[model samples]
Target chain A: MDSQVTRREVLKKGLIGAAGLTVLPSVIAACSTSSATTAPTAAAATQAPAATPTPNANILTGKLTLGNNHSDASDLKGVNAINDAFKALTTLAVTTNTVDHNTFQDQINNYLGATPDDVFFWFSGYRMRFFADKGLATAIDDTWAKVSSNFTAGFANAVVGNDKKVYGIPVDYYPWCVFYRKTLFADKKYTIPATWDDLITLCKKMQTDGLTPIAFSDKDGWPAMGTFDILNLRMNGYDFHVGLMTGAQKWTDPKVTAVFQKWATLIPFYTHGYAGLTWQQACDTLVRKTAGLFFLGLFMTGEVATVDATASADIDFFPFPFMGNSFDAEQALDAPIDIAMISAKSPNLAADLVNAKAYMEFWAKGSTQLLMYQANNGFIPTASDADTTKFDVLTQKAVQIVSKAQKITQFLDRDTRPDFAGANAMQSFLLNFLNAPTQDLAKLQASIQAFWDALPVYAGN
Target chain B: MSVTVMAGQRTAHNVARRRLSRGALYVFLTVLALIFLWPLLYAAYTSLRPYGEVVANPNGFFSTPATLNLNNYFFVWNGGNYPQFYLNTALITIPAVILTLWISSMVAFTISRFNWGFNMLVLMIFTAGNLLPPQVIIVPLYRLYNLIPVPAPLSDNGLMYDQIIGLILIHTTFQTGFCSFVLSNYMKTLSKELVEAAMIDGAGVFTIYARVIMPLVRPALAALGTLLFVWIYNDFFWSVMLFKSGDKRPITAALNNLQGTFFTDPTVVAAGSLMAAIPTIVLYLILQRYFISGLTLGSAKG
Candidate 1:
């Protein structure tokens, strides 16, 4: 009887304990609400300027939020310095939210869907258009109208959506070409090839010299796309390359197969075990003088600079050699533009618009572009009026190549829907082809076509 | 005398065999120890090397002359927001470990000591909660956290989405299931006579649990506490998804920011990882004895 009573008492206590545990969260919630009520008011006070109308204000004067993806230490420092300069020019206080670069790009959909900042860093081309078409990005035509004279027609077209309104402001661009060390070429008595046959001959010569001709890496799965894009641009015209990227031309078309066949011919000259190496590691090979040539963007200079500061001066690139076909002339090349856009879901749209436009106009100025270019010479300024006097020898040569080109194309990933490009479809497809170049082209084409066909049709305005 | 001599010879032979086997065991353990320590030594060695040297000799560590320096450590420490990350991790981990222990212990005590009709059913529910993968409920939990409005003191951003408190609450709630299962089985192995005797001595239920039950479960609590600390400290997924602001992220999540977009030096990454691993190693060392005892406590039920 005593044991039974003890058991009952224990059961009663357990019920009370469980009830207390259940009530604990609610208590915390209630306590948190009381303490947290002041924060929103504080936030609103900071955002108070947005509530008032500024009908005729020319210069934006308020707080502006910017989401930046320049997560590299050097790049972040440079960007922050630019923001500080912007703040000094206008009375607008800028709050910068810096996220990792890859994370920012991968999670952009969710980031934009939620309450995004007033302005966010992004890439130009179909990437900018896709967001603008979905109404996630605000039309920056009003800002573009002010800065129209500052940029070239090519840059302006890159930011314009299908709806005929600008969505982003292009800041900088870099061309992709065959980069080689000037010293290495000078030592080996190798001349820059001007045609497909000359390029192949040069590769064989380099091989006989006991040097890897091309330093290639596809571990990150996007560097190989550079080689593919250049080959396609050289083999087919820019129009067909763009068509293939946008899914307007079939992947199984003979034109596409021809591009792969051309790539396979040069595979023997590439660095062995490239599939496991990163682009930086590949660039290291070039820096260490083990490789002859590397087809990459001007950003390769960043890696070279780390090894030898003066080696950047010894770096020079020529546009991928002409293929001697129907489209024989080197009229096209890859020149991807980096851009910044205003988010449609910004909390204070009016204030955000004024601040974001001011920022765009600031970047449009040659003086502002000069500041950025001077800080990091990885890419050239987009502004035509930017001071070219301060450009390095490499930058000057890049300008020459870009100016000679009749048409410039964005890279494959930037030209297509991000879902298709990033969902391991194209990356893996290219890797599979690189691993076995002699595989049936028909089967490869079919797999790519099937993958593209299975995608849900994107509905956009 | 001859019989005694024969016995002495047999004893000496046995001693020789025992000594030989002990020597073999030592050799085996030494090899095992080296295998475990090899990666750590490599990481430490690589962290001390310059980025240029690391890149130049990717295939082997000893190919180049070892110029051990603290530059990588200095760069990682002074260059990044590691101090803030450490604070964030500690703030989340300490509370999470304590709450999980307290709540799990209370539940285990209730289930083990009580005679309620639904005791076994309740215990089953707690165990079953841990059976499901965390990924299965991540989306729902993400939405729920976003929807929940936390106070400013508890959350700087006024939402549960990017708050340390939210991480603590989630950790405590999700981990309680596993802790309660382990603690309850451990409690069952204890003698119930003491609890019955305490009740006869005019003690209440709380006194019996607090005085009689908890003191006996100290080893288990220490073991669970150490394990929970490491698990909560190393959590990457929830910290990344829940925190909107980079500043709000814990150490493990913040480690991703150490890598630059285009140029990441592996030496700096190695140094950062070694720094991040120090706390868990210290905790394990401190709790070594109790951890071992607690793990083997229920293994043999003789």
Candidate 2:
């Protein structure tokens, strides 16, 4: 009986002990992850390299590692193809480390602070500038000097850091446009809308024809920002849009209110229960001809092709219709460019700096960009000398559309500070407006400004 | 005779009532269990279907079996870097769990057996360590790991950062706190006379702990060992934060590889997740008897 009692006590103690240990830490993990912020590290403060990257008589033979976020099947293939091509040209062996796209973005702060790869794939605009300002990325002026003539002013500006030095090489970019099935349009006998009123009329026509006038989803939070970007760009022009993104212009301004009001006009045309759906599911609607239009990036083609390979051919898009304002002829659009840059903290940087710079220079060349473009045509080359003759019909039309634009913006998240643009900030605000578009605009605008004001200034900035 | 007959009829009626209630209770429990299992079943169903078809009709589960295939499983297995991920997780988790148990048991034995002045204080200190959130220490820990140099066999880069040994060390360090607290409490319930008797027989503290206390605590250790294995295996925060090399990450982090920039095949992701869950499920099943007995042993003290 004594033994039995002691054994029972032992088991009870063990249960309580083990349970406390296993369960509580996971709860702590959940709470702590949200508060994880990057502190500015003491990375090097050197400016642009002074010397031209003329290879010395000594052969460069060390390996250069790359941190890549292009994990999509074809995107990975495209990246690999470029690496293989770059390998054939130099004695430097290149190793690519591929991480999931979203995780890579979330972990970028820690990754760059740690032992980062010698070179890495990243976005242009503020996202690039954010890290560069932290002294995380190496400025590549020498590499840019060799490749400057191959790119345009837009591409050049996208890669420039706040310090006015080039931090990365522009590889490819995809424009955001209104995509619809060409066959569905022809069947409905719909003419392309060139003006705001014409667009409303077309939506009404599409609705009467038993189609969802617009397919929209913000379950992922960032998708709704596209609609906001286009509406703001159309109503207020590129300068105001940039000012608002940079917080130089207040959200409560009349021009910003006007953009929101205009967007409210098209709210009735959107698919119902959109807040629960993903962009992929919404893209399925456009592919199935259940929806008349989807305002998204050019990557919509990839989503479409995954569902039905033949259906991608029927996909066509037009820029958002003119808003009948002064910014109409500005022809501005979001053409977010992907970039490749060098890490200042890479342990192998000293051994492989020459090859790394050579690789960046290689990425800038039109021929090297063509290798990736050939593997994945969804992304148009940023280089001016990229062969247009090899472009497919869609690629040719995309290039033509981008070429005509007088001003270009990166996407909303790309253009703003990451902390302010994260899911908790603009993402949730946009989601709130979408969930209840009729909510008090004044209060919502105040909330946005307050959130922006509350953010700590970037230490390095 | 009538009185006896009336009693017999009442007994039969009561028996019938009890059987009906039992049937209803079983029905309720069965329904609850199916609800719990629905997600896993649905994931299995999705994994067997073509990714395209599943994406096109996310809710349509009434497809023919002919449309179901193992292509997604094959893709996740053959195409993904899962072999390396599994190997890395094993290298990290196995040693971490073993060391946590070994160190914790020794700590537990000392505090529970001895009548030292700081015995409770030592236990409290270990318990308090568990209360510190890992995020608060990540930056400092990262800097510390970078500063510490390991021998060539343990770390490829000389520093502890981005190495398997570093992950193991962190997991062991973080887990030992909770484990020691629980274990010391468990050991305290043991008969002190047993340790006193052994000591009188010329047994040292280590001998008493190994020969007597260890045998008594085997059930508790088994339970903890199982729980620790699962917790450490599923850890994403530490490995993803500390490791720079993608190839060195564990299987939990490998699930992100199936997600693409533009599009993700939910079916393929479901397949990969299900495969990742396999080892944990198997471990639980094998140790299920010990787990159950460990949790219930002291509850019926009355």
Candidate 3:
């Protein structure tokens, strides 16, 4: 009986131990699997440059981590192609950690606060400035010096902080404009409006023809900001708009009120149930010929192409019609520029900075931007010297519009404090305005101002 | 003869009343079933259709029969890296469920079977921990995870930030509370005489807990184990927050990665969701008998 009890005790201990033992190897194996997969890519990075050495080969070496938000398959392909090009040109081994695009943007503060990648994708304007001021991002002034000739002064200015330090390398930009179907315009004999009065007349004509004049959606809460930004820029001019965004100018000012009042005039012509629909759904209304026009970024082509591949050919856009105000040059447009920046919290800061600067320098090259543009034509290349000869008709038109502009503003969200913009302050205000346009503009403006005041003032700002 | 005829007519009336009520019940049940099944049916139907067709007819479910194909499943399986995500999920789920069950059961066994100082307080602590919202702890937990360093063999990044073990630990820690609570209560309902009998028979604490008490609480364990598996498997927030690497993310979190930045194909998303649902569905089905009984077992006592 004693022997039997001992055996039973031993068996129980063995079972308990086995449960613990089973998990360890699996954990190790899982880690090994991830490391093994990355090992091949690192190996490939070193081996490829050996096959065909270019002029700038071996300029930078060692593994550089890149936090990429290019979650789209097509965009990922383009980014990968560019990275491969960079690896081939300069022997830097870049290991990319891709995250969901929207999530990446939302969690960027936390990601940067932690051990972030050596280099990461970001946008320019106040958003870049905010991070740069926080010392979260490394200044790429050395990189800028090498590629200064490739970009315009405007592009360079977008990347500079308030402290006069370059923080990011602008890669591509897309303009927010009034997108319309060319074929539908042709069928209806509708002429592209050149001014605010012409636009109102066109809207009236569209309404008479039994169509929604504007395909508007604010379901995602940021699309309507595009409309508000364009209106504010048109009505208040660039300086006031920028001042208002930076909280230097009061939201309750008459200038802001006028912008809202002007926006109210077009509410009758917007798509019914606009709040229920997403931007893609609004774009669908245009694609299906149910709506006359959509005011969105150049990415609208992506939605149109998804439904009918050939329909993209019929898609064209014009600048939001000049509002016939003091700032009626159509100069101030929303042209959000995507930029790449090196993180200050990089694990191997010195070595990673070398690789990151080299990568940014390569990105700033016109030839490199041209290669990227060739891979994905969603946005215009930022480099002034980028090859535009091969640009599609729509892209060329976008370039022409941007080139002629005296001022370009990033979108409303990108221009202001993220806390104010991201926390439904502007979005809800715009949504409320959309819901009841004629309701107290003063109250709306006051609320917006109050919310802005409530934010913890950034010391750097 | 008149009385007999009246009696027969009353019987016929009663039969008709019963049949009418039964018909109503059937109708109600059918409606309820359809209400529950419609979303699954829609997902399945949408996953079979081409993306363009679905986009064109977003409101309609049964349009464009010609566009229906298995292409989306193929795309989700091959293009979405779903197999890798599934493996990641399994790696996190299995160990988490086992550890949670083992640890929580031990706690439950000790608290229920023995009278010790601060036993109720310990149980209260575990139970109260489960009540706090996950978001409240996210920031502190995120910082903590980043600070803790593990060996290279345990984490490719050599930190807890993107480790599967980190995910498992969080899942186990968070889930153990509810599991132990339910389990302790369930074990309390079991007759103390059985444990007393074991103690009198010279059985050790481990022997009593493992051999005598454990077998009695199989139903509760099975139920909690199933619940833990489903919850951890379907977890998206912790997985995404804890792991930055796409390679380490579970299937639920990986679904977000399948979405294109500019254009997400709806059919592909539907297909991916359906694929992710399969493992949990299979698990629930296999554990169905024990699950229902186990859930009701505690309530049955009171």
Chain A TM-scores of all predicted models: 0.88, 0.87, 0.89
Model 1: DockQ vs. true structure: 0.18
Model 2, residue A106: distance off in Å is: 0.5
Which 10-residue window in model 2 chain B sums to the lowest lDDT? B293-302
Q: Considering summed lDDT, which 10 consecutive residues are worst modelled in model 3 chain A?
A: A40-49
Q: Model 3 lDDT vs. the true structure? A: 0.84
lDDT of 2 at A25: 43
Q: Give one digit per residue, the lDDT tens place, for model 3 in A1-461.
A: 99878766765665566565456546656656756466322222323333232465466656678899977877778788888898787756678888889778877888898878878999999999999999999987877888888887778889999799999999999999999999999999999998999999999999999999999998889999999899888888898989998989999899889989999999999999999878887888888888999999998787787787878898999999986667987478999999999999765555556677778888887778777677778857999888889899999999999888888999999999888887468888889889999998899889988988898978754
Estimated TM-score for each candidate: 0.89, 0.89, 0.90
**Where does model 1 sit among the CAPRI classes?**
incorrect
Please write out the lDDT profile of model 2 over residues A1-461, one tens digit for every residue. Answer: 99878766766666666565456445644544343212111121132332234566323455667898887777888888888777676644577778889888888988888778889999999999999999899999999999999998889999999999999999999999999999998988998999999999999999999999999998999999999998999999999999999888999898877877888889999998999989988998888889999999998888888788889889999998998889988899999999999999886676667778888988898888888888788778999999889888888888888889989999999999988888899999998888887888999999999998899987533
Candidate 2's TM-score: 0.89
- What are the fnat scores of the candidates, in the order listed? 0.35, 0.46, 0.40
Ranking by TM-score: 3, 1, 2
Model 3 per-residue lDDT tens digits across residues B1-302? 99999999999999999999999999999999999999998899889988666557745445766677899999888778766777788789999999999999999999998998898999999999999989899989999988887876676655688788999999999999988888998999989999889999999999999999999888788888888888999998998788777667889999987777777777788899998997777555556666677566556443
For model 3, the docking class works out as acceptable
Q: Which candidate is the best by TM-score?
A: 3
DockQ of each: 0.18, 0.28, 0.24
Tens digit per residue, CA lDDT, model 1, B206-261: 99889999999998898888788888999988887776566557788878787877
What's model 2's interface RMSD, roughly to a tenth of an angstrom?
A: 9.7
